[model samples]
Target: MLDFSFGAVAMGHLVACVFFLKFWSRTRDELFAVFAAAFALFALEQVLIAWAGLPKEEQTWFYLLRLLAFLLIIAAVLRKNRRWS
Candidate 1:
């Protein structure tokens, strides 16, 4: 079940990356750029989490990356809405 959850999160991050890239290409909006960066960072977090069996010590770093990614997503959403409104 843990493996499945990790796989699902990884896939979600990858999909979000693809959509962010598409948005960037289509609109060239800075918000999309932010999203793309955030998603890429999120993807890194997913990768680290998925492969965390390397060393138990690295789990903390993965969690930190996830937190940073979350902050980026929040920042991007706020910026996007502020621009639109």
Candidate 2:
């Protein structure tokens, strides 16, 4: 059901976070560090969504976490590209 899907999504986020952290460690890259943080936030957001059991209408706040994660990714990319120029 929905629970299963949420759990799977959370696990996927966690796995992504771990990989990003590993890449950050190996390369000492700020982009990887930002990515790891974003994924970690996403994983936490999924856990909160699954556990809170909030109604769809009230889930807007939860989605902000996702928005923030994406914004972080965008900001990092912009910063990187600007630095290269």
State the displacement of the C-alpha of residue 25, model 2, in Å, after optimal TM-score superposition: 0.3
Error of 1 at 8 (Å): 2.4
lDDT of 1 by residue, 1-85 (tens): 8767877887887788889889889989877777777777777876777677656675786777768877887887888888889
Clashing pairs in 2: none
lDDT of 2: 0.93
Candidate number achieving the greatest TM-score relative to the actual structure:
2
How far residue 42's Cα lies from its native spot in candidate 1, in Å, is 2.0
* Count of backbone collisions in candidate 1: 0
lDDT of 2 by residue, 28-64 (tens): 9999999999999898898889899989898889989
Q: How much is the lDDT of residue 56 in candidate 1?
A: 65
- What is the clash count for each candidate, in the order shown? 0, 0
